[model samples]
Target: MKGQENKEEKMECKKEENLVSCLCTYYSCSRKGVCCDCIRYHLKSRQLPGCCFSRDAEATYDRSFEHFARLVQEGKV
Candidate 1:
């Protein structure tokens, strides 16, 4: 069906646009501009995307939920 064909076509990601605000400090990472891929990769590793952390925290590369919780408790996030 025409509608099905439209739905089946993958939509283009705004990688360039997303990159403008992407704060992840890992310059060599493949998922730098692709938010969904970054999220999936981190989730699989039991971690979170770097942008979920503050700039300083993100730099520490501690993307664990426990670390985020500590920041939350400290009101530093």
Candidate 2:
């Protein structure tokens, strides 16, 4: 029981660390590290969050879900 709880806590901590690592940092947006906040910030402007794109696409600042979808459809993702 306690062992399982410890393992679960460890997993949760790792997940948080991974989220921090996945932050979209190429832009000056205030929603850099928080995924939900980032998504909301972009969606408010009719844009997609950076995690929706490939590294190349994200670097280009093309935060459009349509563009990301196109990339995936075209096998570029």
Candidate 3:
């Protein structure tokens, strides 16, 4: 029972921990701390998550694959 409780506690802590490091500037995003949901939603729209880009790049809100490619070419990513 103690081990099971610890497992559940860790699961809840994971999301809280993720929220701390999440670089997404979209303050109202529902998927902000949920990596799986965020990845799925962005991929469906042919874009990557904000975490994939640098702080300056992420602030631009251009999450498109093409934008990422350009950043890579420019050695920004």
Give the top-scoring candidate (TM-score).
Answer: 1
Better of 1 and 2 by TM-score: 1
Candidate 3, residue 55: CA error in Å? 1.0
The candidate, 1 or 3, that scores higher on lDDT is 3
Off by over 4 Å in 2: 1-20
Candidate 1: tens digits of C-alpha lDDT, residues 7-42: 566779989998998879999999998998999999
Please provide, for model 3 over 1-77, each residue's C-alpha lDDT reduced to its tens digit, 9 standing for 90 to 100. Answer: 55455343333436687888898999999998898889999999999999999989999999999999999999999
Candidate 1 residue pairs in clash (backbone atoms < 3 Å): none
Arrange candidates by lDDT, descending. 3, 1, 2
**What TM-score quantifies how close candidate 3 is to the native fold?**
0.80
- The CA lDDT of each predicted structure is 0.89, 0.70, 0.91
What's the lDDT for candidate 2? 0.70
How many residue pairs of model 3 clash at the backbone?
0
Clashes of each: 0, 0, 0
Q: Which stretches of model 1 miss by more than 4 angstroms?
A: 1-9
Better of 1 and 2 by lDDT: 1
Q: Model 2 over residues 1-77: C-alpha lDDT tens digits? A: 55455343322234355465673756555556666677678898888877777677888878777887789899987
